[model samples]
Target: MRAGVRNLLNIRTRRVSLAPPGLPRAFDGFSILLLSDMHLGSIPELGPAVVRVIEGLRADVCVFAGDFRLYAHQSGPTFETDLRRIVDAVRAPAGLYGVLGNHDTIDDARLADCLGIRMLVNEAVSIRRDGATIRLAGVDDPHTYRLDDLDRALAGAPKGAFTVLAAHTSEIAADAAHKGVGLYLCGHTHGGQICLPGGVPLLVSTRSPRAYACGEWDLRGMKGYTSAGVGASIVPARFNCPGEVVTIEMRAKSSRTRPARTSCP
Candidate 1:
């Protein structure tokens, strides 16, 4: 790890938050905590820290967006213990949902099942509350080997349900938008793992444009957030773009009024 980056991790993960806009009325007061790109294999403080953050956030639903592990090679052992410990912290009003990132391995299946985490690897599930239904689908990270078929990921979803898709890369937002998805959540860029002045990511993964590097994005009618993530890679430290715990409250957008706060265009 870079000496400077190590020092930042010692300061604790940073909290970057925003409310998801364009939501329909069903989730008016719901809160969903998003954890993505958690490169737990490299960062030591992250696992324990994720545990602490989840307990504190107390969100109604916690979504482990992707990248629970960083190295496919060591994932069998390190993630066997550490990653599960980190992900186990997540809690939702009903249950936690997860997807696999490029770095994740087959071993993640054990942990995902052990923790009762809903594994969304090319699958869809329905969540219901207040006599309303929300359809959520999770797709494996496409950057590694699998071909990303948006149509396949959403094959069985019902129409007019609050459809949310979780993939590892923010680029999937476009596909979600095209498919009329109400919400999309993902994180694979690590928010560039480094930030320049004015919160600009100096570097980013291949999944998206730099503008959508670390926060909320408005894509036509689709709305979502890409967390800066709670872990690291290449180096085990974050500079200006510190680790993140993002709190997302799902509000039902009203036709009568514009959202109280819209994301930066």
Candidate 2:
């Protein structure tokens, strides 16, 4: 138990590179810092620990996949205070964006906006560089809330441009890929908060396939990554699964990459 407790302070950085077809060359090597599931109210020390990890890391953009607090109804002032501290520590040059999770409320979305993190609520945003563009479409929580509208989020997006979908869980992967999403970013499973040896999760509380529970996965031709998360949920201790702050590098893949298949989960 002592080792498990100490594991909370052992947050690590996981770096991954993604090369998706149709990605804009101008956006090649585009770095995105992905953060999720920081249930600050569950563990008091998590807030500062997360801040310390992300203080100097640089990225082209930053995004938060939700669960600002432990419970969905928790709206204390300190939750806001700690969230602000974490948000202020981010170092993304393009901007910071976020999406709400099952354990979040509309109020949390509003608070994220106040803190300079653009909350994407069933909408999309574009990051253009050197005349090339990539779209970031995000939807509401689909796990428990069931408010996600993938079609609405991708309404105005161009068909040929690369699109990255920000969802709270991999449960929405099927729909996002059907709508031509190039990459999907999410975090809710916490990589199975308590895993067996070899990082095998004992329980991955998600409706999607187990493969999408923790790390990079491919749905058809779409590239996806589900963060193990930065803070623990339910319990503050982790076994084989340590908390993580992920940095993803997106590059342009060769045009000859296979076309997206019709299968999905």
Candidate 3:
């Protein structure tokens, strides 16, 4: 199949719901749309398709896991145009937030501002609803940039508040669990982008456990999802692994059924 046809045919949405321990009542049923590894400049034609998919989804908050642009030093005119189109099309009541990926440049912050999306670089922000709050923390790229700092990201979070972290790669899973992070959202491996039959990844480009190559998993004590992502990289084609946009519904764990705390690696 043609690259565009393959991408169009494979782009799909994955919905997941979780009720992790200690979730606040206010955040119960909170829904989030997770988008990652856009790699916009790589395949410019896919931009509108991605925007269309996002526009059709409904969620309280939208989180972009990263790779807004393809090359580290590519010109911004095209990237800015395509990114603005995609960002403008999204609607989220809670807000739109994102972090940078290895292929993105520092100047992409200006693009983020243009799109009205908050770019978090090793920082945390609190979103309130009905007088209750949840903390959203984000770190820099952990792959090519190697600039992630989990401590710095979670330093400003309120004590005992439910915290969700966004990073470019699942490599931070262990560290995030150690810090008591409740949910971790990331995408970089693309589930190998192109995989063998039965969805066996021929290669997963991260230090995270093999199981975390894609989909949801319990990393130590933290709940996490590594998205297959919406765009391709290295090559603009995907085989068995389709591109994805993830929807995560967060429900509060039942108080009576809360499990005892266990040590995390």
Candidate 4:
């Protein structure tokens, strides 16, 4: 009973809307369901809850920001089974994409492929809808096992195409902005994994500014969000910081006007 209560209290869905400059009219109102830092092996029971939440949400695409496992070396068949089940439950017409996180092994790619997730390791792909195109890029983990290659990730993106990048850590927000990436999505901090009252994080583990630790932030001309994550790490308990799945709605800004820049409260 206590476990069930904790699951109910700790997990939630957060909805966010963004209108980045230069978003294509064809892709306006596009919605993406973003999930990160699942840490499946660490909190096994969280899987069913995550699956339920994702299956209930509506999205044009679904993107995972990695850390699918807790202990890299210890992740085994159990982890794969839980991950596959969660992945299968997600529904998106545009498709599903993911990147590797610090806690995941290279072999996790096979599991992702089997589950119909395209693992993007420092790569980019373009998706089209209703005669409009947007580029989606992903880089490897930028935290512990750093292997991120921002240049290569954006290499295939066409000039002036609206681009979104999926990275494990918000530390790359600045670089992504400089490269003209319109939006950057990430999750790894877990909002300190524990916190003070009113969801104030005590210690954010990223190299980025504390302002970018969790929630949305504007980095120069780009927009970025660091999710609190869907599972806990280090310990199976969260204080004021609850686990979450984020839904980002994309709207197109008028061609003659610039989009307003905003930061997380």
Lowest summed lDDT window (length 10), candidate 4: 256-265
Q: Among all windows of ten consecutive residues in candidate 1, which has the lowest summed lDDT?
A: 256-265
What's the number of clashes in each of the models? Answer: 3, 0, 0, 0
Model 3, poorest ten-residue lDDT window? 256-265
Off by over 4 Å in 3: 1-5, 75-77, 255-265
**Pairs with steric clashes in candidate 1:** 23-253, 24-252, 60-93
What's the lDDT for all of these models? 0.69, 0.84, 0.81, 0.83
Candidate 1 regions with alpha-carbon error over 4 angstroms: 1-24, 75-78, 255-265
Ranking by lDDT: 2, 4, 3, 1
Candidate 3, residue 126: how far the Cα is off, in Å:
0.3
Query: In candidate 2, what are the lDDT values of residues 139-187, reduced to their tens digit?
Result: 9999998999998989988768789899999998987888789999999
Per-residue C-alpha lDDT of model 4 across residues 1-265, encoded as one tens digit per residue: 3643394346788788787777889887788899998888765566777888787887889999999987788753468778888878888888999999888888886789678899999998899999889999999999998899999999967789999999999978888898899989998998776777677788878899898888878788687888888887777777777788888888777533324443322
For all predicted structures, in order, the TM-scores are 0.86, 0.93, 0.91, 0.92
Better of 1 and 4 by TM-score: 4
Model 3 CA lDDT for position 130: 82
Deviation (Å) of 91 in candidate 4: 0.9
User: How do these models rank on TM-score, best leading?
Assistant: 2, 4, 3, 1
TM-score of predicted structure 1: 0.86
Q: Write out the backbone clash pairs for model 4.
A: none
